[model samples]
Target: MLMNSNYKVAFFDVDGTLADNELPRELGIYGRIPESAKRALSKLKEAGIEPVIASGRNYEKIADFAELLGVDSVISSNGTYVTFQGEPVANHYLSTELVKEMVEQFQTKQTDFLLETPEEILEYAADELLPENILQFLCHCPKEDLPSLDTEKLIAEKVAPTALNIHYKHVSKASGVEEILQKMGISSDQALAFGDEENDFAMFEKVGFPIAMGNGNDELKAKASYVTDTVKNHGIWKACLELELFEEE
Candidate 1:
């Protein structure tokens, strides 16, 4: 396989993309990165393509994983915080007023939720023990039981809740990727993105080539430019090989 210089950067979703969608037993611990996936990332680096972890997990949760994978750039917290090459690129936080309103609404409905900040995750009327690896804000609530928010109010306040329950109308994985692209002075057409969930839709829209894992959401697969194998079957390696994103040594 020959390297494809057309892609200068690759954005990778964490859960169900780079790592298996399994619950971890310990806090901040994640499933091992498949050896093949590691090799593929190395090859990308050798081919002069930057591989970045773009996940819904907060920076604190994904930092160790990123370090283990040897990737310095990351888009975390559903695009609320981003760092490129170990340098802060952007941090888009939910407005204080919006947070207060959401908290009140959640309390009124007795919904279990957690508030995520750059520093830590705060429990807000949550009853169950916090999971070792908390991915999103909403917890232990069924889709039907989820509290209804004032859509009009949210729009008027210029704030939107993401699929991951992140409240930031101006922030998303796409927005984070855009920041990195601008910093690298590369066009979106030169970027490749891989994702496996509904939250990843925004990211898929921002990239020239979008790949969906075999075990990914059906809707995501439909939007993907290419669909590869499951993460357990070394999908990252297979996709890079087929796309010629990196040369096999």
Candidate 2:
């Protein structure tokens, strides 16, 4: 059953939307939500809007951010997983064949990466590209502290992967978003999303309103419904306010 316009949901991207990109790169470590952004989120909730933190991070990691924002529902792992109030709403594991293929491909390309199962994040070819600070923040380990896993052994044990992430190449976040919407008894047209990256394009196709941050990639900005200020500049809040997401208090 599709509810009309009065029922609305807002999906937020983590790194560039709510939290600053915590990953260390030349991009540096983006910090927590600024005061103004926090205020905006609070105002949105007060207006009876359902605010959801949607990101590529794992279910456990992003749960904390959802707590900070006081949002109970989240679509994590680029939509490969979702949860609400500590209950599993949906879970999508990569096909075993696909997992093996990705591992083989990453090895061939010598790319730095990790794999996430429902339980742990396994590091492989891990180097400076997967920084300690970010690992500590996301998985509670210093990069040096991570343990190596035997992918071959895991295959023998028939282990399942919750999701696959690489330095480059894979399906878009949109695929996960669509799967989640279908599982949740909702349609893409019922939701709005904010994101900033090449990875976010597929999701934009299914959403009712796609907002690109001012700092988003050029291609994403070109496809967005509106290009707003940078995340650091409180672009999301400004755009939401302009869109009447909240009645100005």
Candidate 3:
């Protein structure tokens, strides 16, 4: 059990924690939240904890999963965008000029990629103009074909075996969580988080209770306060029950 049991909010990573995330199918995309996950969220809500999504998915791509799980707040593009109770709170897009320059570099290197924004995804081509709200870039080409640009100013997170989600360096699920908690007058002590990827490590470090899934990254498990079953094995349900996030039957 956690040392603190006064959680007011819950942050969930989408790809593996709350849903079955298999991409190239959902690369920078969200599939669906399983019934077990939905039930967990419902129970968490009954316990008076607000559920929010903290994912690398873009704002438009992460919505259906949020709607399905009956959640309102979403931190998407790895924290480049944020919304609370279905209201927009923040949008931290990558620098347009930098993105364009990177795209040019990709072309010069003959890299094939899919560019994504808060609005849509497009294949990177010299003639095509990037969206004004560009949030991420998914390079389909060889990883080496991608530029070796400094990540101190931006980010390049591997989203799939063949793709990477690019965003600003400061954008991470933890950043959004910190902002949300500050605005809500809540402390990290009042937040519990669950996730299953390298990207989720930051969140695990920030929350009071960090729960890692059985199918999650071993590194993440090493850093977790608690570890649960895999999503397919009812990980969310098990953790909720164990953590007392749900009432006894």
Candidate 4:
């Protein structure tokens, strides 16, 4: 199962991929990054593969995680924002109409939600609106209660909600990956990506090697080039090892 050594970059999803989806005891904190994951990242760097965090989480929320992982590149807010080498690459925002509509819906339905701005996450209704398993940028409302925004309209405007239900326009993890690839002068086939949720579909589609965690969604696994063990079992390390992305010491 050895792969080509041409992989120049590796995009990693946060929850359920690099880290467990469980929340820490501290409020608004994400799960800890495993030591094995850290070692896997180090190996990638040693192999000349640039590691990047590609997550649906907002930039502010994922900043600490990126620092902890020692990664300078990030595709955050489901690709609405991206950075490379600690420099801003691109930033897309939700349309004004879309924002107004969402705010109205949230107010009407009394749904608890948080609005993610460039500066900070603004609490709309109350704290803890997001589930413990998920991050803070999402809302806890039911599908039926969600705003009936026209799908065709969104497509027409190039606006859409991510798999995590966060609304943004004209961007996805795929687009973010493309941005970084263009900037780094690397082709899509020269990249690898790891993911466990539907939000990662775009990233998988963009990368040459898409590895899904064992605990990942069924559809994602079906589409993956390889499926490894769960995060708790050091899936990233195992997959990289099996693919011979880096030599074992």
Number of the top candidate by TM-score? 3
Q: For model 3, how does the per-residue alpha-carbon lDDT over 145-213 read when each residue is reduced to its tens digit?
A: 678776678767777787787777877888999988876789898999999989788998788889999
Model 1, poorest ten-residue lDDT window?
A: 155-164
Mind giving the per-residue lDDT tens digits that candidate 2 earns over 202-234? 778878888898888999999998888987788
- Tens digits of lDDT, candidate 1, 18-112: 87765463533345567898888888888889999997676877887788778899998877788999998888765555566666767788776
lDDT of 4: 0.77
Q: List the residue pairs that clash in candidate 2.
A: 174-203
Model 3: which residue pairs collide? none
Measured by TM-score, how close is model 4 to the native structure?
A: 0.80
- lDDT by residue (tens digit), candidate 4, 18-53: 887664735333346677889999889889999999
lDDT of each: 0.76, 0.61, 0.80, 0.77
Error of 4 at 188 (Å): 1.1
How high a TM-score does candidate 3 get? 0.87
The TM-score between candidate 1 and the true structure equals 0.79
Off by over 4 Å in 1: 1-4, 22-30, 108-110, 124-139, 142-164
**Residue 100's lDDT in candidate 2:** 54
Candidate 2 worst ten-residue window by lDDT: 131-140
Q: Top model by lDDT, which number? A: 3
State the weakest 10-residue window (summed lDDT) of model 4. Answer: 155-164
